[model samples]
Target: MNLSNSLDKIKTFKKVGQVADNLGMETYVVGGFVRDILLKRPCKDLDFVCIGDGIKLAKAVADALEGKPQISIFKNFGTAMIKMDEWELEFVGARKESYQNHSRKPKVEAGTLAEDQERRDFTINALGIGLNANNFGELLDPYDGVKDLKRKIIRTPTDPDITFSDDPLRMMRAIRFAAQLKFDIEANTFDGIINNAHRMSIISGERTIVELNKIIMTDKPSYGFKLLFVSGLLKEFFPEMVALQGVDSVGDKSHKDNFYHTLQVLDNVASRSDSLWLRWAAIMHDIAKPPTKRFNQKVGWTFHGHEDKGARMVPGIFRRLKLPMDERMKYVQKLVKLHLRPIALVNDKVTDAAVRRLLFEAGDDVDDLMQLCRADVTSKNNNKVKRFLANFDKVELKLQEVEEKDQVRNFQPPVTGDEIMAIFGLKPSRVVGDLKEEIKEAILEGHIQNNKNEALELMYKLAAKKGIVNNPDK
Candidate 1:
């Protein structure tokens, strides 16, 4: 198939072809750029593979362009890059690679176009469009990548075992692509992933998390996660998640599989919000259920305090996964801790003080926390789900009302610690902290308005009760 018409539309492709022709080099726009073009997906990065010195081709192409864009060359990797007008073009020599069992890094050497294509992670990514004048825009598909694209399948270009064993990160990439493109992994290719799951230990946490985050960002992340679990890849890196899988029973009592429930929550959150950290919250909301599981004769099974435990577990998990240890991690942790709070409000009579407390604790993340709580209502009973959601709506309304009146979303006590110290002639001691806490609790409990006047009045009254007279030196 000829993509000459499509190639002609992209100015860079034409210029690159001309330059390659002039230099008597065989070059083709290969990998993801070619695949995305056929799929009509928006792609900003382009990879070009040539049979000879790719750096030289990139330099010549850069000189031929309108702005003569600066070329960034990597001498060790034998690749070069040029950035122009939202496009990132990377040039690499077509090469074959052989890996050692201990590492994913391959010994690289120049080879023909076929050799390079064979080394690609998947068939669709191996597709290439000719960038030499003689065969400009010609489609090269030795592995029938177009057919696989139509079939909606993820398959390696060569033997799946050899491919995955060479670079175990491809296992994650396979699952990620299937999730992103809504495709199925071919049986043999999937089997290969399962066979080489242990090899994932060789891959770094950073690389694995990149693929994991991509999967999480997909429209239905559960699909990728299920694949990861079934392929045994998850156990290699994240045994905590795998532990959430099974359901235990004492007589007729049993609990839902927290693993699948977490996935449902993840997908529900994905459908509502595109926030990656919020989705991470969903993934972690029930993460400690296994460790916290208990079976009581009265209640079937209870994962009491799982949310709190899960929150505590977040930092350690983030450290293990090489995820950011900043506010983002804290955000996820906070959500995990508070996920059950909104549901508790839904179950009980919604009160102003309850709503105010939620707003006060959740602060700026109250809305996101509400979204997570809504996603967590994954009851199999339709009526139960409806009832819970309707109650949630009422709870949200109450939250809005309380927040509007009290202005306590990110509430700071109207009475400051310094003020308490000055008033009571005390140092920065527990007494000052106690006064601040009391004032905050009064605001949240609706005993006093969240303003200086009421807080100051109550502070004085409480201080009088404690026999702490106000300083009169002034």
Candidate 2:
């Protein structure tokens, strides 16, 4: 098949072909760019594989361009890169790879394009389009990749076992592609993943997380996660999530399977927001239920303090999964901690103090926290779900009223520790901290407005009780 007409969209392909012809090198646009072109997906990056001297071909392509795009050469990997207009173009010599039993890194040697195609993780990715003069735009499919693409199937070019055993990260990629493309993983290929699940230990956490994050960012993240769980690959690194599986019962009183519940929450969050971290919070919201579970004759099953325990587990999980340990991790932790707060306020006499405290604690992330909580309402009874949603709406209305009246979202105290120290002629001490805490508590409890004058007056009353004289100038 010819892609000559399709190549007109980006004339760079013709230029690349001309340059390859001048340099007498066999070149083809290979891998993801070619696959996306065939699939009609929007792609800005292109990968080119040449029979010989990829760096030289890259430099030539750069020269052929208008402004002479700067070429970056990686001599070790026999690859080069160029930024051409809005496109990122890469060049690599066709090579075969041999992996050791202990490592995913492969020993590379120059090989034919056929050999290179054989090394691709998935058959659909192995499709290539010629960029040489004689066979420009010709489709090269050694493993019938185009047929697999048409069938909407993910299959390895080689033996699935050998393919996964060679680079176990491909197992994650198969599921990620299945989710992103809305395709099915071939049964044999999927079974290979389940069979070689333990080989994932050879892959690094950082690499695994990149694929996992991609899966989470897809339209329905739960789809990929289900595949991960079924394949047994999830247990290799994330046993905490695996621990959430199974139903416990004592004389016909069984708790809901938290593993499936978390997936429902993840899908709910994904439908509402594209934030990967928020979706992560949904995944972790009930992670500690297994540990904190208790059965009572009076209450059936209770997962008391699971939110707090789940929040505490976030840091260690992030550390283990090689996820960012910065404020992003903290955001997920905070959401996990505050997930049940709004639900707690659904009682008959929900107070403004509760809403104010939630505003102060959640600040700007209150909306995301509410989103997660609403998604957490996966009860089988429609009436129960409706009631929870209605209460949530009431809580939201009250929060708005309280916030408009008392302005406490991300609230910094009008009274500071330094101000307390200055007012009482004291250095930083327990008295300053105590006064500050009292002022904040008073404002949150609606006893006093969140203003400096009111806080100042309260400070004087508290300071007098402590036998400290008010010395404003000090």
Candidate 3:
């Protein structure tokens, strides 16, 4: 089918095609740009493959454009890129590839357009639209990519085994695309992923986590996690998450499967917010249950201290996965540790002191923590879920009330340690720290207002009880 009308809208396509025509090089807009056009997805990047020197064609096209935008050339890979007005255009020469058993990196050489299309990871991605003078906007679908796109299926252009084994990263890509597009992996393509799951060892943690994060960021990430679990790919990289898959029973009592529960919680959080780190907090909130799980005749099952344990586990997991060891990791860690706090308030009396402590600890993250806690309600009973959610609402209102009254979220002591030392004529010691702690606690407990006057009064009384008289004149 001719897509000339669509091509007409993108003026750069005509410029590139004219440049390639002048240079006598066959060129087509290929890969995701073409695929997204058919799918009607908003895309800003274009990938063009030419039968001749892509770099030369890139320079010619750059000069042909109105401003002669600067082009970046990768001579080693025979690829070039230029950015023009919210559009990134990439040019590459068509090439064939051969891979060794131990590496995913392919030995590349110049080849025909058909060879290049054959090497594509997925059928849909292999679809190309002509940009040459003669075949402008002509659809090229030698692998029936348009058909697979219509069916909403993920399939390889060639043998699945060859596709996956050559680059195991494609296995993750297959799953990511399926999750992102809400498409099903064709039977044979899925089986290929399961069969070559072991080959993931060759993939770097950085590369693997990129795909994993994309999957996690999807609308309903649980679907992707389930696919990863069933395909055995998750076990290859993240065994800790896989360990949460089963239920243990004692006589007639059994705990719900923590793995599926975590997924449900993830979906719940996803529905409420689009923050990736908050979603990550949901994934890790119960990650320690497998190790901390215990059977009790009275309670049936308990994952006591799982929150604290899971918080401790976050650093090591982040280190291994090559995730940033910055505030983002600490944010996830803090959320994991405090995930049970708001729930405890919902179960208990929702005291001002409890709310103060939670607000102080969670700081600016208090709202996100509440969101995670709300998502953690995964009971099957509708009444229980509704009751818990209603109680959470009450706890949230109390939090807001207390925060407005006390201003304890990320609160600092009204009296500094230096002020205490100077007021009491004492050197820096444990006594100064103890005095600061007392003031902070008294403010949080509502025993004293969080102000210099009330804090100083409490400090003087505590010091007098300790037989230390205030000597501000000293």
Candidate 4:
């Protein structure tokens, strides 16, 4: 089970051993680097734990490198970092951690390698690769982490309750790993996370979002989200998403589980693109459905105006999650607002005018919107899904054709409001606004070409309707 070849990848590991020997320290590459090495997964971040002064050992290794790598030292934390080719290598002294019941931050004391490993969240991550002069390139596995890795399992190195209660964020990290690696959480560990789910309140919103985003970026984000839901962790921070879980039945009518449907959409989008925001749009496309859901005798179920409502909720949700409130937030909001537009087009006539308005509203995000809509069509009936997909293909083709003809993917109205005001000999008023709307509608409706001359002529005709006279000279 020796990773003899894996050792060859770390050229500086031997140098680290020599340096640690010079400083009379015990050091090992620990945490994710060790875990990933065992899993044969590529990792660009390395964490080194030293039983003695890690900073001194770091400096010695820096001097031993061929070019004498620059060491960035953090005195307070007794940590140092060196950026190797394509890898960020970090050095920290072995320390035992004792956490207060109320805070995730632990009181740190310099300790042995065993103590450092004891504080780790998972057994696999607690594995270490020895870099001591006596045992360079040797792996030290106290928890049988290699066996757990082979089984594709995630289990805490220590007591699950104690480990997770100490730092509830690790609970999230555990689920994230399960999703990212497609590993099953060990029985006791999974139950502990569910039992101690309420303890996540101590974790900050920003930190929670970071772990959540990592889960979302995984191959099957729904795997992580389902774990989050089952563990009750999602309800602690993101109740809105959790609220989208069940179906409401009235009379003989029921709605599909929007929660699982949304996750399917997210997975579909993940398969197509790695754009984080686009996947986010998939997650949020029906966020308001629960609040807007209704059952009627006439209609089976209706989430009327849910798209617009979901869009409005984006900023508030982003704020609570401590996600970016800038353009990214706006992008997600725009997608949510328009998530149903493409479907509506698919359901009805694929008019050039309708597609043009969609293109104008979606702008650079038109393609992403279409993708979200395609994923949104999740039906248990295969034929129903196929029919919707066929219609969607038609809508996409129509959109493409319209875009090629009119160049209105993000097209602006050829006539500006200022031009409207000047031509009508009017101030910026309702009359002016009315004319502008008419001109834009005409362009979108395909009644006239999207050119300044045609718009101006139309504008004049509309001005006559408004009883405004254009100055002949001007």
Per-residue accuracy of model 3 over 341-421 as CA lDDT, tens digit each: 886776555578888988999999999999999999999899999999998898898889899999999999999998888
TM-scores of all candidate predictions against the true structure: 0.96, 0.98, 0.96, 0.94
Model 2 Cα shift for residue 163 (angstroms):
0.9
Clash count (model 2, backbone only) = 0
Query: Model 2 segments beyond 4 Å from truth?
Result: none
lDDT of 4 by residue, 1-474 (tens): 455468776787777777888788878888898888777789999898988888887888888888877889999889999987787889999999998999999999999889898888899988888877677768888888888999999999888999999999999999999999999999999999998999999999989999999999999899999999999999999999999998878877788888999999999999999999999999999999988987767978998999899999999999999999999999999999998788767655457788889988999988888888888878889999999989889888878888889988777778888887776567778877788888889999999998888988898788888788876768
lDDT at 77, model 1:
97
Clashing pairs in 1: none
Q: Give the TM-score of candidate 4.
A: 0.94
Model 2, residue 274: C-alpha shift (Å): 0.7
1 or 4, which is superior by TM-score? 1
Best by TM-score: 2
Q: Which stretches of candidate 4 lie above 4 Å from their native place?
A: 1-4, 347-350, 418-434, 463-474
Comparing candidate 1 with candidate 4, which one achieves the higher lDDT?
Answer: 1
Give one digit per residue, the lDDT tens place, for model 2 in 87-171: 9999998999999999999999999999999999999999899888899889999988899989999999989999999999999
> Each candidate's lDDT (Cα)?
0.93, 0.92, 0.93, 0.88
